[model samples]
Target: MPVPAPTLAAPGESTTPVLAAATDVTKSFGRAKALNGLSLSINAGEAVGLLGPNGAGKSTLISLLCGLRRPDAGSVEMFGRNPLDPKSRLQLGITPQATSVPQTLKLRETVDFVAAHYPEPTPTAELLVRFGLADMADKQCGALSGGQQRRLLVALALVGRPRLVVLDEPTTGLDVDARETLWQQLRDYRSQGGTLLITSHYLEEIQALASRVVVVDRGTVIADGSVDDIRSHVAISKVTLEARCRRRPSTLGRTRSARPLRAPERPPWSPRTPTRRCAGWSATASNSAASKSTPPPSRKPSWHSPAIRKPPRP
Candidate 1:
């Protein structure tokens, strides 16, 4: 889908002020902590990307921001009001990782249904066309493909014309084209002074859209800065190599310095070495006599037998 270039907000339009904040928030599941003393704040018209690996608590923080869950300690506020307050969330929109709409409902009907909940919403027809769902307007949600359904899920979030939108892995299963389309829509929203909080594992996703990036790992923020600043701090490159060699490598690549192993090395195995040395001369003589009597077994010339012998169990 091709969208017209988004117009920039007027000077004052972009100054809508801080919309959400999570101060020293901590949340846990059973004995596992999901978020620990995390702090974040977002203002109107800013696009902030929450970057993290799996199980990094990005979702937990989002749940608290959307008022679906509460922090065990610290606080979360939306528009200076508790996130749990209905009025505070009126200006918020969310598209969680998984979404389910009435399977039997037509796409158009679903949009209309969601639109009815808000006092003022983007026109249903306009929303549908903007999201490239005009052709599937009458199709049942269940009949749409996964990509189409994902587009609809995100479209519904914008129906309320929310000032702040929170998308969790919004393009998780989308193709390149679908993902780009969604990105354009989000860009337009931010261009019009809307605040965005998006969490994704794809670095390209964050780099393309986020002015500021927050990297989370093991339930805490590890890096927070403008996208460029964060990139500068993490100026590392990844390289992969494949080669055939008889010996294992002590280092991955010759271009990089290698650190020696810290642990002590074990002694090498040898066929001639006995399991244990005889404690005394009598014990040694008895072992020597037994070895002489048995004689050394003859070596097999080849291991090319049709059936190989299984090793004896210890």
Candidate 2:
């Protein structure tokens, strides 16, 4: 269930400065609506997680915040100015969901190129080492593995030392160790008062880095609250049962029988069994064991899956 919206501040009321905001925004592409009256705000020094299932408006909102696209209605602001204004974006950094660098450029060159855009960028050597790409600095971008490229993309985003960092699925292709490393770096960034707006499919990732969460679904803001609040609304209940028997039951042979056992008339040892049976109880047991031993069918590669054939438009 969606949580109630927070109370609004009255005009002239002092409040935390908003670093980024999208007010009653609506955007459409062709006949598809990507965002519909979605409103969100990021205050200074916040770590906000934007989450939803595939085709949600998470990416569309990020693009608007970064000035890559404009809203068809309403407004998007960054640092109290239009996001398209160069001054407003000077303190901004972004890592999009799908990224590609010039394949011909070497890793070190790529980092240097991006760093040159900012007035006070992190040293290229330091940035490369920090992301564990020091050894691969001389390799061409094309030669790097998917995980390496992902790491490089994140490293470039931070090279500018921007006050606000927006990341879209930043750890998509990363392994467990690499993902943990990135998370630690982000935590440190937040410690230094850097505001962050991140979207990721991994719920645990959001729980680890974000204090607040904003859920988008069907091109609208469905829920917005602290992590605890969101968890309370969506938390699942689980029950576990454990039973013990003194010894193997003598009626093991009747396990596959179709007969139903009435609790009042039958001993607990002779529990109800399946309505269907194999040739014999022993044979059924053997078949079940064999099935357990068999390996599961191999899954097709992600690219072959229809669900992920292309990055979701939303």
What is the C-alpha lDDT profile of model 2 across 203-306, one tens digit per residue? 55676677787878778877787765555444211000011121443443333234433311323443332111101111211222122222111211111122
- How accurate locally, in lDDT, is each candidate? 0.69, 0.68
TM per prediction: 0.72, 0.71
Off by over 4 Å in 2: 1-15, 236-314
User: What is candidate 2's CA lDDT for residue 267?
Assistant: 31
**Per-residue lDDT of model 1, residues 1-314, tens digit only:** 22222322332244558789999999999999999999888877777889765678999999999899889999999989999988888888889888676899999999999888788999999999999999999999999999999999999989999999999999887877888799989989877877788997555566667777787876788777766555544432110111211133542232122322211111122111111110111111212212222211111111111012222123
